[model samples]
Every structure is written in structure tokens, then in C-alpha cells.
Target chain A: MLVLTEGLVELNVEAKDAEDAIRKAGQLLVNEGLAEARYIDAMVKGFQDIGPYIVVAPNIAFPHARPEAGVIEKGVSIIRLSEPVKFGHPTNDPITLVCALCGVDSKSHIEMLQALATLLRDEDKLKTIMNPEASKQDVLAII
Target chain B: MKIVTVCGMGFGTSLMLLLEIQSIAKGHGFEVNGEAVDLGSAKGMSCDLMVASSEISSELVDEPVEVISINNLLDRNEIEQKVMPAIQKLSKKG
Candidate 1:
């Protein structure tokens, strides 16, 4: 996969649920002309049912929908929260990292998941990405 | 031996926890196999014990396997303190 990294970083994001997070991130993608704006809402709802499964790390969350959920192109958007957002899971502390991913199918999505897993495994790299002062270039550099 | 770690997503916290368990098991001279599985899909997995998030453990009560609930998935000390005993107990059974 080409790993879409251009203009994928949002300095601040507001979200109440996995759907909200993905919608916010998808807006960024659409604004940058990377994907269609009309598909954003459907993508958000498509992942809502499996949304609760997104509590990846203590302060990190990855919200993704199924491949068939209006995904015209495979892409990723990284959003850092100014303040943490709760997803109703006790084990998950408020989240800072909100990664929105869209793919063509399960196999393609798993590749993105593996890439995300690799990035999240690095504590120092994650801390840098979560930093408010960090630029989009800095986030892209790490990924 | 098979060990499975459970969390909200099979890809993130559970995978990290499984890595920790694998390292600890290796140090103890145990050749164990481990994987991270989402709570929804862990039903038929052959695992000696299920190390799961507290939320997941509550949902998995009826399973025959034992469940060890973990508070912070990244806290190595906390995981060792809580999970080591469960592993030892299962070892005795084996």
C-alpha cells in the first residue's frame, strides 16, 4: 500500500463517539481533496456498530469503518485531541490519538491496522505525535 | 501452551499485553504460544487463561477458562503483578 500520509494530520479534533471521530477526521481528508465529503457520514455510521472496539491504548483510539463503507480510496487521518474524549470504556483513559482509516476490504484494512500497531508500539513516537506543539510534518516524519 | 490476551480491539492493547506475556513466559523457560483476540471472537480459542481488560472479563464470565483482569494495558509492573500468579496457577494444572 502507498500509505497516504499527505495532509493527514489535524492539530485538534473534537469527538463524542467513534462515528464523530471518524467524521471529524474525514472532513479533513475531504477538505484536502483526498476523498469525497459526501461519504463522510456513511463512513462514520458504518463503523459505529464496531466502534466500541476502537479502544486501542490508554490514551489512543483508532476509529475505522468497514471497507465497503463508501471508501473510494484508501487513506488515513491522524487527529490529536486538545483534551481527551471518553468512549465509555473503563480501561481506556481519555484518548489523545484518533486515527481514522478507510480501506478497500478486510485484507487492505488489516494492512493499515498492522501499520498502526507498529506505530503505536513505540512509546516515544506516540508521545511526540500527541504533543500539541508538534507540526504535521513532525507527525508525518514519525509515521 | 496457548495464551490469549483480550481487549476492545485485537490489534492494539491486547497485542501489547500478549507481547509482555510472551516475554515473561520466555524468561521463565516456558515455550508458550500467545495471540491477541477480541473478546467477541475469543469463544473457541484454546487458551489456558484469558488476560482481558476488566470490561471484557465481565462479559466473558461463562467461559470455562479463567480470566485475569488488567487495569492498565501498558503498565508492565501492574500486568506482572496481576498476571504472573494466574500463569503460575495454570502451570500447576498443566
Candidate 2:
């Protein structure tokens, strides 16, 4: 089973900008042995070349790269920014959430993606996770 | 009706959205089928409708296909609100 460990979670992260935010999120996955270090650069370039399209929703940016970019295993990482960063998205700028995804293959990350979508959809649940008062373990249980 | 969920990379957020849309549409009795596609592959593509986060949806704009922008990709209620009407509208056209 793919595990969402506390080790993969970083709350209220301080980032200089979107590039920094993406790298920090990518580093979380890499540190957890879920992805390679170079995967970080891939995600950054993805934004530069592809535009801020990674800002999938308002206040949320789901940064990811191809599986070949450096995915050693399938997993996801959660990084909440202390101050929201801009991805230049027309609507979803100043993102406070960065969810970095690493998949061994296309099919494997589907479950995690579904679960994440469900959790993020619930405003109450998202509030609790982002409340700063909520424990990391609480967010873990929710995820 | 056919719909597609799009993201910069098809396998990530778009795939996430496709599953949620599929689940929501099944219960709505819309008889819809859809898939996840990357923006590059999605261009010049046609479907009854398309769903995506606002930033990506703006790029997805084209004729003969309508794009439904979901401001909050994580919110299921938002998806239902934005998508059901489109599905209802499109299914009627068929």
C-alpha cells in the first residue's frame, strides 16, 4: 500500500515564490524515497514551459512531472505554504497548497488522487488541515 | 454524452478530476462517459463538454466543445453544480 506518512508532510512552509514552493514539495517526495531529486527540477520547468496551469484550483497547486522525471515509487506529498505564492494562474493565483505527486506509472497513483480530491473538496476538512491548530497527525488521519 | 477533464499533464489533476466527474455523473443519470487528457492532446479535441480547473480550462477553449470551469477542483459540490447543468444541457441536444 502507498503510505502517506507524516514524514512526507510539511505544514506552513515558508517559500520565496512558486518555484521555491514547487521545489520544497518535490523535495518532500524525494526525501521520502518516493521520487528522485531531479524530479524537483522537472516540476519547476513544467510550470515555466507549461505556464501556471499547475494551479489546478484557487489556493491550490498540484505540481507534478512525468513518471520518468524521477519517480522511484508512487506517492504524494502535502506542502502548505505559510504565505501563498503566485503561479500566475488567471483565477487560481496566490496558492497556499502544493500537492506534489509522484507515480511509478499512470495507473498506480489513481487511488491517492481520488482520496486527495475527496479530502480537498470538503471545505471543513480542508479547513481543519490548514487551520495551523490542527495537529499533523490529524491531517494524516484525514488524508 | 462525452466529456473530458484536462490538466497540464493528463495523468495528474485531470485524471483526478475525471474520476470525480465520472462518479458524480453516474448518479445524476446523465449517461456520460469521459476521460482524462493533457492540454496538448486536448487541443482541437471535441466532446459534449469539458471540465477542468479554471486556469487549465481557459486554455481548453475551442468551438463545438464547451468548457466548464471549476474554481475549486477539490470541491465535489462545485463540480456537481457546474457540471450537472452542462451535462443536462448537452444530453438534451443529443
Candidate 3:
């Protein structure tokens, strides 16, 4: 359970679609050395080919690729957008939080998935995380 | 027991729903095996039941699927009230 601080949040972030947002977020991870730079494009392309399913909860998005898709280590990156981003799902308003993940293996990925499930289930906590005024400590504290 | 959870995306909500299903099924004394795949992939996988959001359920047709459309992924009561009955019905059929 690695917590991303400082480098993850992109204020007033803009993207054309869900895939663009993920690509931008992945690039941030690469810049921080949290993941390989090559993974950014592959991760974005993978989701595009598959569909925009990563826009999970109404305001939350988790963009990821399979374990074999150039992940050197297991990691998680959090990005809080100052404004919401759309993924074309009418029920989903707009994404306020983006959790970009890379798992080393399926077992670890499952554990990570479970933890994420629990976190997103909490509406109050999700609101706290999505707040741009909230610090890294506040985001980590909620999780 | 085999279970499949569906959401708009295979990566997020469906995965989360599967976790809750696994936890509930485990408590109910069932040995469960679950996975989260996109609604499109549901046609290819064989499972005892399929749990999905109400929006996704409308698109599915002509499968032996026992579809449970959850209103909210975080609501355990909704899962119990809506999803559990569908699973039970499927279990009895098998």
C-alpha cells in the first residue's frame, strides 16, 4: 500500500476523454519514477481497445493494464482533478479522482482491488479525497 | 461457487463489486471463486450468477445469466436485498 503525495494531483487537469486522462496520469507516474515511461502509452491504448470501463464509480476512475503490460513494480498513484473529467457514461457525472495502478502480479492486484473497493464504497471519504484543498495527509488518512 | 460482477468498466466498479460478493459468500459458508469482467465479456464466461449495474443489465440478451442489477456498489443492504435473491435462485437451479 504505497501512498502517492505531491506529484499525483493535477490542478485544473484537462483531457478529451477517459483514455487521455489516464495517459496523462501515467506520464506523471513515470516522471516520478513510480513506473516505466513506456507504460503510459500502453496503459492508455489498452483501455481504449477494451473500452472505457475504468471509469468505475461515478466520480472515481482507476486506470490500469494487465500485469504483463510493462509494470516493473507494484504501485498506486492518486490524482485529484480540480475539475471533473467525463468518460461518456451518462450515469457517471464526471471523474474527480483518478487512481492509476500497476500490479506486479494477479494476487497482489486482487488484494489491491479489494482495498480499492472498500475505499470507493465510502461516499464521505470519497468526497474528502476529491477535495483539492485536502492535503496528502488528508487523502492518505481517509484510506 | 462461481460469480461474476459487471460494471461499465472491467477495471473498477465490477472489480469492487466482486470483492463484496466474495466477502458475503464467504460468510454464508460458500466457497467462492469470482472475477470482474466487462459486461461485453460476460457472454464468454460461465458463472453461477452475474451481478451488474442496472444500466449494464439492459444491454444483455439471450444468455442463461441470472442478472442482479445493483443500484449502488457501496450499499450492502441493496446487495443483500437485490443481489442475494438472484444468486440464491441461480444456486437452486443448479
Candidate 4:
């Protein structure tokens, strides 16, 4: 099961820009031994190469790279920025919630996304989690 | 009908799009053969319609398939609004 543990969640983080936000989220996965240090760079470069398509919704940016970029395990790190940052997306810019995803393979990646998508469907729960005052324990209960 | 969801790496965002497309198609009472592919793989593939983020969708302008560019991938309402009509039209022609 994909669970967002205490180690995987950050709240009210201050980031200068989109790259800084992505790095903060990716760093959580690295600290948990879920991915290599290179994974962070790969994700940042992916944004530059691919554009901000990862800004999947209003105020939400899902940053990720290929597994070969160095995913040691299946993990996701969720970070809520203290201030929203622009990602150059047409409409979904000024992102506040950053989800850095890493998976071992195809099946696991989709599985993790499926779970995340379901959780995201709950607007009330998402609001609670997005609140800067929300604790990691509160997030753990929802995800 | 066949549809393709595309993103840069094909593992993350495209897959999320594929799932939403599948569910949306199912909810609309029609079945679609949906697959997710990277931008490189998508060019050579044959499909009736292609859904991708606006950024990646711009690169597909030269392709033969009908391209639908979406701002949000996870918003089902947006997906249904933009994609379902085309799907329904295709269903009627078929």
C-alpha cells in the first residue's frame, strides 16, 4: 500500500521558485532512502525539458522523472509551500502543493497514482491537508 | 475507439491521464482502447484521439490524430468537458 508517512510529508515550506519547491519535495524521498540524490536533478531537468505539464491542477504540481533516473523504491513526498510559485503552466500555475513521485516500475507507478488520485478526489480532505496549519498526523490520516 | 494519453516520461502524468480517460469513457457508457505513451513513442502510434497537457500537445500538431490539450489532468470535470464530446461524436460515426 502507498502511504504518506511522517517522513514523506512537509507543510508550510518556503520556496523561492518552482525548482526550489521540487527540490524540497524530492529531498524528502532522498532522505528516506527512496531514491538517489540524482533523482532530484533529473526531476528538475524534466521540468525544463518537458515544460510544466506536471502542474496537473490548480495549485498542484506533480514532479517526477523516469525510474531510470534513480528510484530505489516506490515513494511519494508531499509538500505544501508557504507561498505559491509559478510553474509557467497556462492555467495551473502558482502552485502550492508539490507531490514528488518515484516508483520502481510501471505497475507500481500506476498503483501509486491510482491511490493518490482517489485521495485527491476528496475535496474536503484535500483542503484539510493543504492547510498550512495541518499536521503530518492529519495528512497521514487522509492519505 | 482508440485514445492515447501522453506526457514526457509516460510513467507518471500520462498514466494518470490514461486512468482518468478510462474511467470517464466507462462512465459515459462507451469503451475506449486507451494507452499511455511518451512523446517519442506517441508519434509513431496510431490512435483516433490523443489527450495530453497543453505543453506536450503543442508538439503533436503535425500528427494525424485529433489532439486535445488539457490544462489539468486530474480534474475529471475538465476531462469530461473537453474529451467526452469528441469521443461521443466518434462513437456516433462508428
| Per-prediction share of native contacts kept | 0.24, 0.73, 0.20, 0.69
Any runs in candidate 3 off by more than 4 Å, and if so which? A9-12, B6-16, B28-41, B53-59, B70-77, B92-94
| iRMSD values, candidates in order | 4.4, 1.8, 3.5, 1.4
Give each model's whole-structure lDDT: 0.70, 0.82, 0.70, 0.88
Candidate 3 displacement at residue A56 in angstroms? 1.6
Best by TM-score: 4
**lDDT tens per residue, model 3, B1-94:** 5888886546556776887777776676665688888777887678777888755765665568677776555667678777666666656766
Model 2 lDDT per residue over A1-41, tens place: 43689889899899999999999999999898888899999
List model 4 lDDT by residue over A7-98, tens digit each.
Answer: 99999899999999999999999999999999999999999987887887788888988898999999999999999999998777799999
Docking class of 3: acceptable
Best lDDT among the predictions, by candidate number: 4
lDDT of 4 at B64: 88
Alpha-carbon TM-score of each model against the true structure: 0.71, 0.90, 0.80, 0.94
- Candidate 2's C-alpha runs over 4 A off are none
Q: Which residue pairs in candidate 1 collide?
A: none
Q: State which candidate, 1 or 4, has the greater lDDT.
A: 4
Q: Tens-digit lDDT track for model 3 on A75-125?
A: 777777666777655466587777788777766666676677677677788
Candidate DockQ scores, in order: 0.25, 0.65, 0.37, 0.71
Q: CA shift at B55, candidate 4, in angstroms?
A: 2.5
Strongest candidate by DockQ? 4
TM-score of chain B of each: 0.87, 0.90, 0.84, 0.95
